[model samples]
Target: MLRSPKDPLSFDSREKIALFIDGANLYGTAKTLGFDIDYRRLLEEFKSRGYLLRAYYYTALVEDQEYSSIRPLIDWLDYNGYKVVTKPVKEFVDQTGRRKVKGNMDIELAVDAMEAVEHVDHFVLFSGDGDFRSLVEAIQRRGRKVSVVSTLTTQPPMIADDLRRQADHFIELAHLESRIGRDPGERAARAAERQDRFARDADPEDI
Candidate 1:
């Protein structure tokens, strides 16, 4: 069973904390809020909260595509403070002969969280997937406080009731928007610059 923290935890330089982000889930949530995540700001926000030992981001990439909409964000996160874990998205033919996209990082995230539990005082998870309820239970058993960062604002609730009830604390993502949301004008200016550069340095195959 999961239990709530008795008190708000403090971030001493010695308090070990690790962040495990479910990339697709987090991206979906952020997209719903109409903004790109400023990973740098995300890192700084947590670093100020505790001794951040690691920040892991997990995503499945659709390889063999000419271009992926999420490629740039993945690249940016890789070069930044995040330790990005990516695997090629698997495509399978279903019984109905329909193609299905198969890419879930739940197992991977759980494994990492379990491995890091002993090393960290606090574990922060950026996902609302119900599959993680057991993972949270296991982490809590290790005596490490686990905080689930998702939202209850969306219809049907973005967080699973079981998971929320099990966590040491629940942090609604809406509360962190001001700390992580990218400025619209700044994003627009960057996009415009990229378009201009693409036009100027076009290759025959690049188009």
Candidate 2:
């Protein structure tokens, strides 16, 4: 059974809520649990709790690529209800002479969350980065409830202990699979579509 609004972990139907999704982080977490998030279901799940003020999705895009694997999902989110924030990935050579791509959206997420404090009564962050612990505490101090969504069911645990402890509520993503996970058949269909696109885009001689 779901807890009542009186519970610190539960939401009051009247409160204003906003979702901040760390796209890469969330994708990695869900993949570890062998599931894919159904964004439409995710939005509905929260909208049922309160007035959903906004659903923000943050990601880093490789601008140099002619076609990015994540472009389709980003476009879908933009067309849907999500507020997508994207930045270009920075590529650099590491000390060991290995190429690496860096695109951390922590600052952007934090800034947006802080800006929402005046309008939102609840903040739902979809990332387990321990770095957000301080941000969670700050939001709580501002008198807004903060819920951190991530999973601790994996071998190494996807959530940081500090972040989980700091949040007013810690929602394990594994527990939400049934509510927001994509159906296996639907996932297969999407996968096949992506493969077909890839095939069509490839050079005929390479096929």
Candidate 3:
């Protein structure tokens, strides 16, 4: 059985910690696991573990759009103690005549982590990208601990083996589902509230 968050092997309460969340990666992993992360719960979980110096969330935004699906989540995170870093996604057409949006925030996250190392004793990286292996190794060299949060419970696994091995500790996201997962009932309630609001705003003639 996987250990819980309270397990001593997971974190040191006395240490100063910082969280680096790769937003897109985390969302993809959680969706793959058939769950949604309650960001409030996730922050509270780690805050209870140690002195949470910072919690940084990174993502790419579709700038030209009048509305983005991610905007609300980003706003919520920003208002609720998370430092959000975002950049406009670049749209391009390939030789195959397919359009694509590129918005990788790996470099931004790495730079922030490196800058934060001086103030934090523990780094909790919420990403499965193997490209961060070098960043993890560098942080470890600074005499601080690094804990990676990703899941291996999925068929192909969400975490990269190289990145997993590079970290000083690995905390499977599956083990944290109980603490950070969103309640289905809460989601239903929110949906109902939205429906009620829509009904209130509806035109009588349209109805």
What's each prediction's TM-score? 0.85, 0.88, 0.92
Clashes in candidate 1: how many? 0
> Compared with the true structure, what per-residue lDDT tens digits does model 3 show for residues 1-207?
236555523666799999999999999999998889999999998999889999999999876888898999999999999999999987888899998887699999999999988899999999999999999999999998898989898989999999999988888887778889999899999999999999899997877
Positional deviation of residue 53's Cα in model 3 after best superposition, in angstroms:
0.4
Clash count for each candidate, listed in order shown: 0, 0, 0
Q: After superposition, how far is residue 131 of candidate 2 from its true place, in Å?
A: 0.7
Location of the lowest summed lDDT over 10 successive residues in candidate 1: 1-10
lDDT of each: 0.84, 0.91, 0.90
lDDT of 2 at 35: 95
Residues 1-207 of candidate 1 have per-residue lDDT tens digits of 213233223345667889999998988887776677888998998898878999999998776877888888889988888899888886788999998888788888888889888899988899999899999899888888888888777887778899899888888777677877788899889989999998889996878
lDDT of 3: 0.90
TM-score of candidate 1 on Cα atoms, chains taken together: 0.85
lDDT tens digits, residue span 16-71, model 2: 99999999999999999999999999999899989999999999987688899899
Per-model root-mean-square deviation over C-alphas: 4.3, 3.4, 2.1
- Ten contiguous residues minimizing lDDT sum, candidate 2: 1-10
Where does candidate 2 clash, by residue pair? none
lDDT of 1: 0.84
